[model samples]
Target: MTFVIQLMSGLAVGCIYGLVAIGFSMIYRAMGLVNFAQADIMMIGAFLGYAILVAAPGIPFWLAIIGAMLGAALLGFVIERVAIRPSVARRADQVYLVLLTLGIGIVLSNGARLIWGADPVVYPTGLTHQTLTLAGYPLPAVYLYIAVVMPALLVGLHLFFTRTWLGLALRAAADDPDTAATMGVRPALATSVSFALASAIGAAAGVLYAPISYVSFDMGVIGVKAFAAAVVGTLGSIPGAVLGGFIIGLGETFGGQLIATEYQDSIAFAIMIGILLLKPTGLLSGARR
Candidate 1:
């Protein structure tokens, strides 16, 4: 029962990582550059939901999450238009865009500090009272939600990528933007949509994560974990992200319990390093560039 509980808890965190990693993977495939500040954006959305709920106590929790997601999506769209687009146009240097994103993240985090205060605030679980009990082993309702949501999202994404025309356009842009353009597809538009999608996914993770771990300025590291998951699963593999996330999640849980908890962070990085060192490509074969 204890082991099941532990694995399930890890699954929740892993699912969040998987959800965020899908955006990271998809965007990278489309744009060839990593969104360095994705984690920070997620943190901002999480905080936005908390702020809304805290202020209007009348706003439903689910509504707050949707509002936060939309707000983050709009912010991403604006940032891409105002910052990324201009930088890409003026100079093709990748580092400039990378630095721009990092700066944007810093600005948002600091702004959040001012608005929400430096002190971290926890979002009410809204699911706090429920538990699934099996033979006296208690599981948080949030875990069940995360477990279901991740797979549902993955299936939806798979269908969107395979069955929808826009999804095909995104993939086409990812494969070859110039050729895609030759076919009348716009890569920049895809990039913008990718950013918005990434932001929304990150916001979702933040909402799902709020109850499990108190919302904090520091939660962006969860985004880093998702990045690692993306790396391990192979850059463009959605299933790989989910698989890698679960592996990391389970590893973090059992490794901490049986070994030194201080080494948990290192363990995850070590896995990433080991996978890259051994496979060089990633766990999935077709996911490489």
Candidate 2:
């Protein structure tokens, strides 16, 4: 029973990681740039949800998630237009673009500290503390929420990318911008939309994760592990990112249980390193790029 509960917990955390990793992969695929600020965008989303909850305590949690997503999406769009797009327009070097994103991340983290303060904040409701008894085992309600939300979210994404014209355009733009543009798809618009979508997903991850842990400006540091997951899963592969996330999450949880809690982070990194050594293309290398 304890093992089962631990497995659920790990899966929940892995889902969060996978969400953020998807953002990383999406941006990489569309813009060919790794937005280091993606996690800070997640932190900002958590704060947005926190703000919404505080302003209207009676609002549904799903509403708060939507509010956060919209808010973060707008921020992402502005960032792309104001900073990233201009650099890309100028044909900046990849190293410079990466450093710009790193700087943007620093600005975001510090800016969040100024706005939300340096102290961590928790959700105001009892939902975070809720639990459910399942087959004689107590399960965290947040874990169940994660289980439900992750799959639904994945389904939504699948439909969006497969069924919608905008989705098809985005994929075409990412795979080949000149060809997509020749087909009447604006690559710039697709890039902007991709960033917004990625930001919204990251925000959703932040809001879902905030209940399990406190929301702090530095919480963006968790992106480090998510980045490792992206790399392990194959940086440009969406399915690979998710698989890497679960691998890291499960490895960390079991390692903490069987070895030592202090080594959990190390265990996740070790697993990532081991997997990369054996399969450099990731577990889902053959999946969508």
Candidate 3:
């Protein structure tokens, strides 16, 4: 029962990393840019939902979640438009664009600190801590629901990329931006949509995480870890990000059992470095495509 609980908890948090990594991978593939503020976006999404809930008091939790996702999506699009696009247009160079994203990330995170204040905030999710008897052991209801959200989200993403025209266009842009542009798919629009999708995913993860982890300005650093997951999985592979997230999640979950809990945070990152050192291309060989 304890082992199962740890696994469930790890998977829940890992799902957040995986979801954030989606944006990390998407931006890297599309614009060749890495936004360091992805996790802070998640933090802000939770805060936005929290604000909505506080303002309207009667708003349903589900509705607040939807609002949070939309809010983050809008922010993503705005960031790409205001902070990234102009610099990109001015400079055709990749490193210049990368530096631009980094600057944007710093600005966004600091702005969030100013707006929300430096204190952590908690938003109740109404998920009860009551334990249910399962396999002759008690299991928390929160863990059960959380375990389902990740796989369900992954399936939804898989379908979107494979079935929908927008997703197909995005995938095409990720594969070859120059060719996608020639084929009547605007790479800029694709980048905008990618940011929006990634932001939505990040916010959705935030909504799920709010009940579990307290919201704070420093949450953006977690996005950095997610970036590592994206890199370790290869920057553009959706499936690979999920797999890498799970691997990192497992390392953190089981680290306490084998090693000390003090090293828990660094376990996944160490694995990421190892993967980078051994196979720079990552587990998925075709991410550049």
In terms of TM-score, which candidate is strongest? 2
Candidate models: Cα lDDT each: 0.79, 0.89, 0.77
- Candidate 3 Cα outliers beyond 4 Å, as residue runs: 128-141, 286-289
lDDT of 2: 0.89
lDDT for model 1, please: 0.79
lDDT of 1 at 44: 85
Candidate 1 lDDT score at position 43: 90
In candidate 2, what are the lDDT values of residues 177-223, reduced to their tens digit?
99999999987988799889889999999999999998999999989
Clashing pairs in 3: none
RMSD, every candidate, angstroms: 2.0, 1.1, 2.3
Error of 3 at 264 (Å): 1.5
- TM-score of each candidate structure, all chains considered together: 0.92, 0.97, 0.90
Q: 1 or 2, which is superior by TM-score? A: 2
Where is model 2 more than 4 Å wrong at Cα?
A: none
